[model samples]
Target chain A: MENVLELKNLKRHYPIYGGVFRKQVASVQALDGIDLSIRRGECLGLVGESGCGKTTTGKAIIRLDDPTSGNILFYHKEKKDGVDIATMSPRQMKKQGIRSKLQMVFQDPTTSMDPRMLVKQIIAEPLREQGGLSSRALENRVVELLELVGLTKDHPMRYPHEFSGGQRQRIAVARAIATNPEFIILDEPTSALDVSVQAQILNLLHELQQRLQLTYLFVTHHLLVVKYISHRLAVMYLGKLVEIADTDDLFNKPLHPYTHALLSGIPIPDVQHKLKRIVLSGDVPSPLNPPSGCRFHTRCPFVIDQCKSEEPVLEEVESAHKVACHRKNEVRKLVYDQFG
Target chain B: MPKLIQAEDVVTNFYTYEGVVKALNKVGLVVDHGATFGLVGESGCGKSVMVRSMMRIVQEPGQIEGGKVVLFFNGDQQQEAVDLLQQSEAYMEDLRGNHISMIFQEPNAALNPIMSIGDQISESFLFHRKKEMSKKILEDLSADDCRVFLPLKKLQQTLYTIAADNPKSFILIICSKIPILSLWQRRLKREALQRSIDIIRKLSISNPSETVHRYPHNLSGGMKQRIVIAIALACHPMLLIADEATSNLDVTIQAQILELLKDLKKTEIASILLITHDLGIVAETCDRVGVMYAGNLCEVADVEKLFQNPQHPYTKALLESVPKFSQEGRLRSIDGAVPNLVSPPSGCRFHPRCSHAMEICKQTFPEEIEIEENHMVACHLYVK
Candidate 1:
């Protein structure tokens, strides 16, 4: 399978100013040296806590936030060489047709859409950006998009606030795919919704992905939702990728200590299936002054002197499983011995 | 276990411009002493309105039309239960933060941004613990090794003695208006602040003294929630109502808070009424569960039975809709959206979307019946 998107050494830092002259005291390392790849027509789930930079990686790939340094390689069939979107300006991206191929659906549907415009105008905004469609064609396309997202033709005449949360999210999905994008970034798309409505949106996304052969970078903190949608899973901790593996492999036996703790923290809906939870001692450290060496050493239960002094690099411990833990072997043995 | 609180045929309505919104249609439930009761429903399903009506804190344009809320004191079944609906506004005000306190959903919105954390928490102490605090101040003033000035201590002693008898005394109100004389109760205020610090420390917050001095904006979401919990637990209320208190927090922080609440249940609070939409939270924390749909109570059962063998069609569909970990095939979503409460569907509001709805379901509401020992279901399918 061809790779749709590749991120190499991506970094984003926001400088904090203090003192009399407003000098730069320090910088928050929001995204520090992230390396990831998304294959064509595959959903990659990015799971992390609030400040782990999952949204930052999504924004950097779509150029919502400019990266400090790195290469975002986007491949096109006609062009054998992949284009570096990291350096592309807004106009350059539009001119090269990359803007239409990549799109994003925000977390909150209420604030992302305009209240003054009707649903027809909201969906037609993207088609109008692409240009060259007549008024009749645009109207037809708006009606088509509405039906595609499981809404009636009359829905295009209603404003955003007139619909419920589930219906509004459906409108947001309609707008995202209006441009026929091949890859989409869903940033906590279903977090703000109720469980039943969340299930509806998840099913819609699943059906759309299969029908269009679309690739997804599904970023969310909900573990079960990620497990349901993604083919592969990536666990991030304080702006760095700590583990990556197939969804089943990672869920069954996560290697990194952070990944294991995160998986166990989730409260399973079933009453009979009780799994022992590994609750981290304290809160996540601030990104402004992250802990030295391993970022997770401060809260890790199995921390050692070596872990506090030296950083471990991400390396493949198995065929398709990668972990960035110095004590992966010992942790794995202990986990297996206890559970088996 | 004796009943701590019970509501009978609670009906709440919102008189909107469009029409009347029947938010709660004869909702009824019970919470026993030393038990955690979970209310599960989607947004606008009247789970919140039912609790707010019981608390008598429903906002303007909303009114609790007809209901009886009976509150029993402690575990004594022999004692006569008090009808809270017939109580005066002043009596209810005293009962709010003293016997029954509530923790709101959004901590940022619930807390005042300008006030320091210490002052906000201590305010609860001042409201409900005034007599207790004033008695403590009297002890300090009358001690053998007292350090207060002689003349000032004499005036403070008289003031605190009156305060201990009646917190709403007229003489204290007059003295509070005087410029320099108002400072006589400084020792009492200090006592409340000390109690606030102790409660914050009890929640396992490190550096409670420093944390009390900071404002709400300086703290994280989890820390603000802890402050809210501190205020709710200040007076050792009999019932603590947590309305989606942990929904906005991260999973790890949520686990910590849930664990804290479980521990506190064994030590401090008598019973808890938890309102949330997550079934997982209900399964993990609640002893019994009540499922609400469109302002109506559909089912009430033990947590284990509700999860394993759901009786109501709506409850069955709700349990099926949630995605399990690494679930196979397509998810079976509930077919329709929640109905509009302003002009809700006739009869059972869930009939329009229920898979097993019968012809009689659209005509009249079903009476709640006990199918098993501790399980009750309100559905036409179960009525026969």
Candidate 2:
């Protein structure tokens, strides 16, 4: 499969002002130099704590918030070369209809959809904005989209608030797929719903991915949910990618200290499966004034002098298993000594 | 072990603009003394409502329509058992935060934003320990180490005496309204603050003095959560209900909180009622488990047994839906969403979503039957 999306040194920073003149004193480094790639029809799980910039990465990729710097290389199906989404102006992106090819499912379904608009109108509005369809064709497309997301064809007239949390999410999903986008950014898609509903939504996402051949950037804080859905997992700390590996490899044999601590943190349901978790000390540091060198060094259990001074970039120690840590080699032995 | 709390036939309803929403319908469960009894279910399944009803803190428009929440203070002491439903408002108030306490889900929302952490925690002590503080003051009066007299020493002692005699004294209430007289509570507040610091310190919070003085906004999520737990533990209640206690925290922080709770359960708290949607938390922390669906507890069993041999289809579906670390392929998600509580399904609430749903299931609710030792299930499929 071809690389659907490639992010190179993506940096999205918000300037912080101080004093009477409101001069920019510092920046809230939301997404600092994020480098990643997503293959065709593959789900890449972005897992991190709150304020760890997973959401910012999503927004930057789709240019929901125009990134401060770096390139978001998006591959078109027939195009010889990938286009830089970061450089494209909103009008240019819309004119080329590249924006339609990359759809986003927001975290909260309630606020994501306009409460006043009917479900059909909200789902149809996407197709309408994309243009060139008959009124009859648009109506049929809306019904088809609703049916695709497991909702009845007649739910178009009902408002978003009329539906349950799960149903509202289904409507949101229907809207995302209305244009038949090849790549979708699901930002905490099932976080608002119940577990039973989450499972249903996850299953629906899986089915849709298989049927539609959709590539996904699935972002969430829940490791278990991400583990189930994603083909590969990327662990992020304050504004930077710390690790990337296959889902199984990441969980089974995490190399990075942060990843090791993170994977251990997910409490397994069975008591017999007693996880010897390495709970890192302190909370995730603020992105505004993130720690020197490795951003995770502040909370990383094994903080070497080298880690404190020199920044470690994501490097592949093993095939398809990349880690950003000075002590990635030592982490295996440390985890083994403690948990194994 | 004798049951600390025996909640039988609890029927809670919310009189909303739409209609009377039956939040809990004949819900029943047992929490034994010294055991962490976990209630597992999806949100809006009345797990929270059940615990809230048990605490007699079900908010506005919501009422416990019927049923008894019998609490055994020290267990098997028949004379000590009192149905919380029949208790007077004052009696329930005394029982709440004294015998039973609760830890809310969100630390940020749970803690008072304007209040200092010390003040909020100390309020529990002030509310429950007025007599103790008064007795201490009287004891300290004779000792050489006793602090110097206030501007109104006689008035302060007299106020303490009145407060010690009756916490809700009419004179104190009237005095409380007066600007100058309200200062009488200063000594008591100081003692409570001291105790609050000790309590916060015990929750593994370093720098108790600084943390106590700081507002909720100044603290991190974990610190705020610890402070919440400290407040819940201040009274040393027989039962502590941590309602989704670790849901809003980071994974590492969640592990720490869970560990703290486990440790506290051993020495600090007697019995814990852990109400959460995470099956993992239920499995990891709880000894016994109860699975609720739309208001009805469909299954109750030992945590290990519940996970190993789940009888009810709902429980089975819930456990299967959780994407385990050891498992691969598609998770076995239950069909359909939770039924609408206002007009809940006629017979078995879970029948509409159950795979083995029978004709009888739609007609009447199934009674809870003990299939195995200590394992009880309420499902038509398990019917004899």
Candidate 3:
């Protein structure tokens, strides 16, 4: 499988200001040297808690938020061209057709969609701005996009407030797909919705992906939703990717202790099969001053002397299974001994 | 067992600018003594409203139009059951925190902003125990002794009062930097503060002496929720209504809170009416689960039975909609969104989204049928 999007040593840091002179006091490393890849037509799930930089990673991929330093390579097979979107100028990138190849679906549908604009205008605005289509052609494309996302043609005339949460999200999806982008970044797309409606949206995304062959970078905190939609999964902590592997392999044989703890934290329906949940003490540390060595070592259960001093790099231990932990094999053995 | 809390034909509605949102439609549920009755549903399904209605805590624009909330008191000389809905507003106030209490979803927002954590927990104890304590303090006292104790009692009462009475006099006389009476007043206040600290420590909070002094903003999400739980359990109310108490928390914190509630249940024997959207939480904590859809209870069954064999199409759809790790890469979602509550779909509310929806299901509402012992489902497919 060819890589559609790749990140090499990505880092995004925001400098803090303080004192009477407004001098730089310190820096908050939001993304610390992340290396990841999303294949063509594949859904890559970025799972992490709040403030873990998963959303930042998605925004970096779509160029909505520029990374401090990294290489973001977007491979466009149709044109047989590769563009490093990280350094591309906004206007130059738009003219070079990079904007039309990638888009984003925000988490909250109500806030994301323009209240003053009608559904037709909201969906057509992207097409008008990016594709530069005529008014009539834009209207036609809006109708088609709405229909593709399971909305009626009449929906275009209505304002966003008139629709339910799920319907509003469908409108957001229509707007994201208006330009027929090859890749979409779904940032907690269904977190604001009910469970049943979440199911509907998940199904819609699945159906749309199958029909349009769309690739996705799905960012969410819910493990179940990630398990449902993702082909590959990446577990992130603080600001770095801890583990990345095939969805099934990651869930069944998680190499990192953080990954195991995250999976066990999820409450399973069957009470009979009780998980020996590793209740992590204390809150997630501030991103401003993350701990030394591994960022997750503060909350990690299998913390060791080496894990406290030496930073571990992501190394492939099995086929397509990569883990960034000093004791990945030891953690795997512990998981097997207890769970298996 | 006798019902601890019984809500009969509760109808709650919100008059929004758009329209009248039918939040709760003739909802009826019972919470037996020491039993945890789980109300499971998707968001906007009125599960929270139904549980909130029990405590009469539904906010403005939303009112309980018609309902009877009866609470049977087991620990009394008379063994009487009172109709909580029929009580006067003043009398209902006395019953609220002492007899029935509620813990909301967001703990930070639910707690008082200006008050210390100790004072908030002590308010419930003061409200219910003040008169009794006063009597106990005045017991075996002569008329002259009572007169002597009067000034001390008045001073104690003034010290405990939360209202800002006589701010000038209080500042000059009680809290002055080097006043003669300030030292004695400080000692008196310290004694009252210690009582509040003892109550907070009873909730198993770490370092209650230190925690009681700080405001809610300094606490973490789980610690804040624990404080809220502590406040709700302060009075040892007969029925505890947890309205999405753990929904905002992460899974690890949620499991710990659930375990805490379970332990509290065994010791206190307080009936819990848990309102939640996650079926997994219900399966772990609840003994009996009631699944709701569009303001209707679609199914009610034991947690084990409901998980093993869900009879209602809506319940089955909800269970199947949850992605399981065992079935990774093969999970299938339910087809359509939940119907609008204001103008819900006619006949069966879940028919539009149900997989086994029939022609009859779209036109006729199904009656609740007993599939087996203690299990009831409302679906046309299970009628025969």
Candidate 4:
């Protein structure tokens, strides 16, 4: 299967300024090296705590913010195929139809969408920017898009504020799909919504993906939401990928201690099944100067001397199961012993 | 066991500029001594309002129209439980800091900005135990040997004359050293301030001495929350109402705060009425849970039972909608948004969005049904 989107050795760092001269004191290593690929029609869930840089990784891929360094290859089947988007000039990227090819559904639709814009204008803004749409044709397209996203045609006249959070999100989705993008980054699309409404949004996303055959890079902090929506899952900590595997495999057997602890920390809704929660001792380390060797070593329950001296590269231990840890086997044993 | 707090048919409504917002409608829940009861709901579900009603903290435009919030305080002597709500405002004022305290979600907002953290914490002791405190002050001021302290006695007489009307003012001037009353006044203020510093230390704050002097804004979010918790627990309240206490924190910090609250609950032997929108937090910390929707409790059950075999359609949908790591890629979401509480749906408030909604659900509200010994749900699907 041809990969629709691929990120290779991506890194994005924001420099921190200090002192009288405002000199560059240190850099927040937001996205330390990351390598990931999303196949056509696949949904990859990126799960992490706040400040783990999962959102930064998504922004980097969509070129919402330029990456400090790396390659972002977009496989556009229609036009010039296999374009390196990272190196493309802003004008060239627009001309290459990169923006329309990869769209983003932000975390908060209430804030993301303009409150002043009517639903029709919000959805049609992408089309207007892409050009070549007649006034009558654009209006018709907006109505169709609204209906497709489970809204009435009359909704086109309403403002974003008139809609509920879930409804506004649907309008955002409608806008994302207006350009008919091949890939969409859903950044905590349902986190702002209620559980029941969250379910509706999740179902809508799933249905939209199936109908459009679109690929997704879903970023969220909620593990359960990731589990339900993602075909494969990646666990991030301190701006680094700790584990990546088939969602079921990762949940069944988490190799990285951080991933294991994160999974165990989530309290299951079932009352009969009591979880032996692995309470990580310390807070997430600051990104400015993450721990030596492994960024997770400070809070890792199974930290050893070697873990502090050498950083572990993400390596595949089993089919579609990759982990970055000095002692993957030891971590696995500890997780199973505690959870199983 | 006596009920620590009982709210019967509580109705809180806010008269906003737009319209009358029925924040809470006939909402009722109970908290017993030494138990943690969780009120779980989505945003705008009135969980906060219900707990805020207990503290009489609901602000202007928000009126508690029809409800009796009965707080039964076990008398210090007679062992008889007294209805705190029936007491006068002055009595309630006295009881606020000492009997039933509250910890809010944002610690910075809850704490005083200008006051030193230590002074704010000690204020509780001052308000509740002023007589006992005065006795301790007198003991500290008394000289061990009257003969050697004759000059001290003369100074005490002058200080007493100055303190006859305003002790704080008299002590403040003497502590600045008029040369005569410096030592005694310094000792007095230091003793009171030391007790405040001691409470900060008891909350497990890293450095009590430094933390006591600093204002609320200087501390981290978690540390501020801890300070607020310390102040709330200072007077040993029988019931602590935590209103969205951990909602503002990050997940790891949230875990630590929840753990701290749990530890405090056990040590103080106080009941906690935890209000939150996150079901995951409720599952992690709450022993029993109540689900609210559009100003109505749809279900109430033991945390385990609520999660495993939820009888109400809303509860089942809520559990199903949560995306779990174990069930990635197979997530199912419920359709539709929450109904407006002011003018809720005629029949079942949740019927408009329910997947299993029937025709009768659109016209008639379901009565509460007891599915198990302690589990109760209000949904047409379960109603006999």
Candidate 5:
């Protein structure tokens, strides 16, 4: 499969100031060296706890937040070479048509959209931003976009507050795809919705992806939803990718300790199924002063001396399965033995 | 199982500017002793309102129009059940945080930002356990040989004895009102703070002593939730109502909190009334489940039976709507939106969206029927 987007060691840091003089005391390394590739039309799920920088990575990819270092390569079929968009200004991105090819749907649809605007205007904002569409053309486009997102014809006249959470999310989706974005960053889009409504949105997203051939960077903490929607999964801990594999492979044969813990911790809806949950002991450490060596070493049950002293880079342990752990094999064997 | 709390024909309404929104319409359910009862519903389906009405904590513009919240505090089944709704505000105030306590959805909003975590937890002890704390202070004063000038110590002991006999004593009330004389109960406050530390430690919070001094903002989300649980559990209430207590936290933190609640249920709390929208958490934690829709009780059954053989169409649809990792298919979502409660459907609120709805379902609300052992469904299909 051809790759649509590639992140090369992307880093985003925010400086923390202190003292009377307000000197730069320290920095919060929100995105500390991440590498990822989203294949064309594939839903790549990013799962992590809050403050783990998954949202930051999504923002950086879409250029909503400026990256402190590294390259974001967007491959265009028309152009022979991949374009490095990490350092591009907003004006440059708009000039190069990168803005239209990338869009984002935020987590909270209620807050993301304008309450005063009608649904049609909300969806047509992006199209209007691109310019050149007459009133008749804009109206037709808005109706088409609404229908694509499963909204009724009359919904275009209603305000966002008049719609339910799920419907508002559909409008947000319609707006995101209005510019015909090839890659969309969905940051916890379904987290704020109820289960039944969440199913509707998820199905709509899946259908839209198929119909539009859109690649997605789905960032969420929901394990079950990610397992159901994404083709591949990436687990992040304290700003770095801890593991990446096919969704089924990661769920079935989790090598990284954090990934295993996260998978086991989910509450499965079935009554007959009982998971042998490896509940992690402590909370994720502060990103400002992440633990020395491996960030997860503080809470890892299989921590060793080497894991505390030396940082482990993400290495491919199996075919297409990558993990950043010093004792991945040992942890895997123990988990297998315990489950068996 | 002996009944712990039961809400019968509970009707709650919110009188908004637009109209009267019927939040809870004749909702009824029973939570047995030592069993976790889960109330699962959508956002405005009255799950929270039902519990709030039972606790008599419904905010302004909302009224619990009619209900009998019978609480069986005596686990041995000897004492008569108390109707919480019929009680005076003073009695209800005393009953809350003493026999039945509630944990809210947002820990940040639930906790006071200005107060230290220790002071917040100690407030529960100070409010409901006043007499006990007074007695404990008296005991401490008698046990200690150190003298604060012997006569002053004697006077302090006499004051604590009065506080122990009647917490709302006239002299103590006047003293509490005054600035300088309020120090008379310092020992009692200290005792409550000490008990706060013990309860925080019981929740397995690291550095309980240190955590007590910090504000709510300083602690992590999970730690703040644990503190909220500590405040709820400080008095060791007979019933603990956790309303979406873990919904706002991350999955890992949610797991930790759920595990802690499970352990606490086994050791501390007698019965848990967990209200949430997540069926998965209900399946994992609850012994029995109640499905609520548009202010009405749709179904009630054992957790396993409800999952395996759901009776109501809405319940079945809800179960099928949740995406399963082990299953693959296009999800069958319930068509149409949740009904508006300002003027809900005449009979069954779910009839409009229900696939198996009959003519009778639109005319009158179906009476709850026992389809099997401990399984109750209130659908017109089950009526026949």
Candidate 6:
């Protein structure tokens, strides 16, 4: 598979102002430094707790929130070369047909959609804004998109509120795929729906991915759902990537202490198989003033002297498995000895 | 063990502008003593309605149409069981927080924004712990020889006696409401606040005194959740209804809250009716699980059994729907949406979505059949 999207040390920092001057007192390091790469048709699941910059990374990729620094290199297949999206201004990117190819689906379905617009209008608005679709052609395309997401063609006539939570999510998916975007940022899409409906949406997404060959950056706090949908997974802590590996490897033998703690936190839906949970005490620290060194050292059980003073760079510990921790081998050995 | 709370053929309905939404259609359930009973279902499946109806706390226009909620109360397990539906309004009001309290889903919305955490938690104590506080004060008064305020002490003693006997009486209720005459309750309020501090501290809130003084908006989601749990546990009620208590929280925070509730179950409450749509929560915390769908209890089994050998199609579908870890593939989803409760399908509410839904399933509702010991399935296939 060829690389579709590459993010090199992307950073999005919001300034925190106070007092009379309203000057830049400090900064909320929302996305301090993110470096990730995606294959043409692979699903990369970004899992993290709240305020971990998973959403910010997704938003920044599409230029929804302009990053403070770093390169967003997009590999346009037609041109046969990578174009640095960071260098191009918003206007330049819009004129180059890059905007239509990059689309996003928000977490909350109801809030993301317009209530007044019928399903057809909502789905067609993207194509309408892009121009060059006849009224009849647009109607047919809207109906086709609805069917692709497992909804009936007739559903295009009804309003969003008329649909159930699951159906509303299906509509959101329909609208996202309407523009034929190669890569879609699904930010917590199934998090709001019920398990049954979540399953439906997941299946629909999988089906759509296969049919359209769509690559996805699946962002969610749901570890289990991410493990199921993503080909590979990346774990994020306070504005930094802690671990990234094959989904099964990460779950079976997580290298990073934070990843280990996070995986164990997910409650297994079984009564007999009682796994020891590494329930981290204390809340996620303020992003405005995160921990000094490795961000997770504050909550990590395997924190050491070196972990407190110096940040550990993301290093490949094994085949394609990267971990950001000073005591990776010791942590893995400890987890294996106790849990295996 | 005796059943802690039993609802027999409970039917609750919400009369909206469109039509009468039959939220609970003859729902029957029984929670045993010292057990964590979980109710699992999707959103809009009436899991909340069933629990709310059992507690008789359904919102406006959502009426408990026809059913009896029989509550077995021994407080210390020494009295005859009483039917809660047969009790008077005042008795029910006393029983609500004293015997059975609830932890709502959204802690932010559940708690009063303006009220301090201390007052919200202490209010539970004031409603339920008046007699205990008054008796303790009386014992102290009798022990102390100093009689500086002899007349005031006598008046206070009489007032406590009256309040303890009938907390909802016009004089006591009026006084409890009117802030001016509540000077007598200052000591009781102080005791309640102290107890609230203790409970909050036990919940792992570091600065209990500081937290108690802050409003709901001042606290984080996890802290607010802890405070809500503290309020629910303030009176040590027999049954605690955690209605999706940890749903709105982050994964780590949710893990903490779930652990807290699970730990508290052993030491605090006798029975916990844990209501949530998350199967992982049910499998982890609950001993027995009840699956609801479109106002019907589809399946009831031990947590292990329900997860392993699910009988009803709906239960099977729901269990399979959860994105299993490492299966980065498509899942077999239950087709069709939950039927409109106003005009639900004639027979089983899940027939339209059930893959094994037979002709008989669409004609008449199936009786709950116990296929195995202690495991019941409400499906036509199992009816024989």
Q: What RMSD does each model have against the real structure?
A: 1.7, 1.6, 4.9, 4.1, 1.3, 2.4
Error of 6 at B351 (Å): 1.4
Global lDDT of each candidate: 0.91, 0.90, 0.81, 0.81, 0.92, 0.87
Q: What TM-score does model 2 achieve against the real structure? A: 0.97
Q: State the local distance difference test value for candidate 5.
A: 0.92
lDDT for each residue of candidate 2 in B1-384, tens digit (9 for 90 to 100): 988999999999999999999999999999999999999898889999999998889999999889999999767998988999998999988877878999999999999999999999998898898988887876666467767566567677788888888888899999999998898888888889999989988988889988889999898899899999999999999999999999999898998899899899888999999999999888888999999999999999999899999999999888888888877788888877887888999999998888888999999989999999999999888756
In terms of lDDT, the poorest run of 10 residues in model 2 chain B is B142-151
Best model per DockQ? 5
- The list of candidate 3 runs beyond 4 A from truth reads A79-81, A335-340, B16-19, B75-79, B131-205, B328-336, B344-348, B351-367, B380-384
Candidate 2 lDDT tens digits, A260-287: 8787888888868986778777788888
Candidate 3 Cα deviation (angstroms), residue B146 = 20
lDDT of 1 by residue, B1-384 (tens): 789999999999999998999999998899999999999999889988998999999998999999899999856564678878889999999999889999999999999999999999999888888999999889978999999788888888999999999999999998889998898668878898899999999999989999999999999888899999999999999999999989998888888888889889999999999999988889888999999999999999999999999999989989888888748987888877899999899888999998887889999998999999989999989754
Tens digits of per-residue lDDT for model 5, B1-384 = 989998899999999998999999899999999999999998889999999999999999999999798988775464688888999999999989988999999999999999999999999899999898888778778886755878889989889999999999899899988998788978887888899999999999998988899999999999999999999999999999999999999888999999999999999999999999988999999999999999999999999999999989999999999977586888888877788899999988899999998899899988999999999999889744
Give a tens-digit lDDT track for model 4, residues A1-340.
7889888999999998999999999999999999987888889999988889999999899888899999998898675468888878888988977888889999999899998888888999999999999999999999999888899988999888899998999999999999999999999998888777787888889899999999999999878777877889998998899999998888887888888777876656555556666767756878988889988989888889999989999998998888999898787677677656
- Residue by residue across A159-237, what tens digits does model 3's lDDT show? 9999989999999998888888999999999999987778789989999999999999999989988888989999999
Q: Per lDDT, what order, best first?
A: 5, 1, 2, 6, 3, 4
- Interface C-alpha RMSD per candidate, 1 decimal: 1.0, 1.0, 1.9, 2.3, 0.9, 1.2
State which candidate, 2 or 5, has the greater DockQ: 5
TM-scores for chain B, listed for all candidates: 0.98, 0.96, 0.84, 0.84, 0.98, 0.93
DockQ, computed on Cα atoms, for candidate 1:
0.75
- Residue B138, candidate 1: alpha-carbon lDDT: 91
How good is model 3 by TM-score?
0.89
* Deviation of model 4 at B126, angstroms: 4.1
Which ranges of candidate 4 are over 4 A from the true structure? Answer: A19-21, A78-81, A336-340, B75-87, B111-120, B129-205, B214-219, B324-334, B351-384
**Alpha carbon lDDT of residue B191, candidate 2?**
89
lDDT, candidate 5, A175-213, per-residue tens: 999999999999999998888899899999999999999
Give the per-residue lDDT of model 6 (tens digit) for B149-214: 888888778777777676557887777677877788887888788889999999998889888999
What is each candidate's DockQ, to 2 decimals?
0.75, 0.77, 0.46, 0.52, 0.81, 0.75
